[model samples]
Target: MAQQTASPDDSNGPESLYILGPFMFLGIVFFIVRIYTRLALSYKLNVSDYTNAVAVLAATITFGLFITAIVHGFGHHSFYITPEDSVIIFKCLYVVLTVGLFAAVFARISLACLCLQFTTSTVPKIILRAQIIFQIASLIATAVVTWIQCRPISAFWEAVPGGECFSPPQSWAFTATGIASDLVCAVIPILVISKLSRSLVERCLVCFLMAMSLFATAAGVLKIIYSYRFDRDPSDALRDMMPLFLWCRMEEVLLIIACEAPFLKSSIERVLRRMGLPVFQQKTKDLNSIHTFPDPRGSQGEAVKKDKGMKIDERKLEACEYTTSEDSTQSDESDGNSTRQQHGEVTDSSQSQPMSTPMDDV
Candidate 1:
């Protein structure tokens, strides 16, 4: 990729900053809406559902803070010009690092929530526990790396005029850890959901939700790639890319919210209905009423009786038994009559036995 230099004038420029503001605003709104929806479904949902909501909230806050820091850093440059400007930039970088750490933690929790829905076996549970542990470790590592990225925290924002700063390796390690976590979270859902017992439609829906994790993975990759270039030149272009970083963070949080949307389908539909959208209302009502069974002995009893009568008659059983017995007796008598004739024929050879022969047979 070709490297583009970001002009100082572009820092907090009207256009770039303006566009990011609305997106950040919408992200905050979405996060609040998601929290409210989760609370509504809390009675029906499991612990994981609430956990996913919290994860999204954490990720949102992280991104929101990072965006604020970017705006602050860039906004400062809008009026002043000096090597000390790097100080403001580094402060923003610290905020980004802090947010990145939180984002990692939140992503892992969100993945755990997804895993809970599909897991039934002990092995999966163990794997989930391990993932959570690793996530915590990753968070701690990130925090430590960020703090050490700039020696003497005060030097991060105010130039000492001659002190040597640490290399970008610290930032690299932090970014690499986040990328690894994102990949883990993305792939874990595929494995877990694949083993779930669900209809094709249900499976597809879940797969789609799982697919949203790819956005996070993409963000991770972008962050890593951009971090590499930023490491080389840590310039204004890298700084302006803050919007992309904010987007990367926002994508993860939004995806977490999206994954949980199914749990709020009923509530969403209800809200839609109240707004006078008839189709959603009817569909939601229909789904809600599905478990209700009609009483056959009540209003539909006559219809049931009519259908049953068509397949069965009251006297058929009685007539069938009598006719079967009569047929059997007639068949026995015919056999007896034939045997008498045959005996008469045999008697002629045995010197004439009367045709009537006594009832006992000759």
Candidate 2:
């Protein structure tokens, strides 16, 4: 048995993956907390809501991979290429691809949930269904590609004594297909959102949701670029770990937050209002004042009629009081004949008289 030589491109050195691990773990924790809070507050937390479950599961898996990569990176000091090292690297790449595909599916589902909220028309419904079907097909394709990438799945991790693996180009092809599906999933939401009829505020909110898909797209692109670099030289350890694993983890974190943005926004608004912050006062005022008048012949007729008459009479009295108070204040201010206090008393009396009006039955 000969001592296997490490590849020349394998630069054994410290890398960014070690530093990214804990942060990715923290992101996973935060994602779980947010999801739990949301579920506790919601009417019923249904797994059938594919968006929520996918976001959560994707985050969990990504976090797990981040930890696995970190352990591998730290445990193996030599970033250089040994036959054993190549096995670990390829296994990590497999995990990265798996997490990326799951995250992409989750992102698409989240966007679909947003579309469902805004769209009621047949066309949008059909489009949404088509997107979902396409996503399912893409998932199946990616799964097949993943399994086929390594003929015997154990070859991906457990190195057979003399067994050969597929070339890097084959791996790259599978990766490229996964990335294409990711871009499709991300862009589809933006298209659906653009067709929706929404107020400026609502549109902005939906756009913000759609923008999250971009993170996943970027992750896919970064992974694709790095997959080529890794293929070119398997020994480029840092290149192999950082973009391939870190970006995918970051994408999962971002997707979780983005999917929960609407719930988070309302929670923040509620907290701010409780703290006496003037956030959304205008919107709140409009919402509070929106009311439908009762029909005269309905059960609410007596109360509605009384309210209407009282409103009219109060307005008339308020106008008369304002006129009298204005005249008295002007006279007092002009001649300097009346004491300021006495003039104020007269104005107050006139204004206060309206408060004493009787509200006997009509």
Top-scoring candidate (TM-score): 1
Off by over 4 Å in 2: 1-41, 47-51, 74-93, 158-162, 167-206, 236-241, 279-362
How does each model score on TM-score?
A: 0.59, 0.58
lDDT of 1 at 344: 17
lDDT of 2 by residue, 87-125 (tens): 665576677667666765665666555555545567766
Q: Which parts of model 1 are misplaced by more than 4 Å? A: 1-8, 12-34, 44-89, 168-177, 187-199, 232-244, 247-264, 267-362
Global CA lDDT computed for model 2: 0.51
Query: How much RMSD separates candidate 1 from the native structure?
Result: 21.6
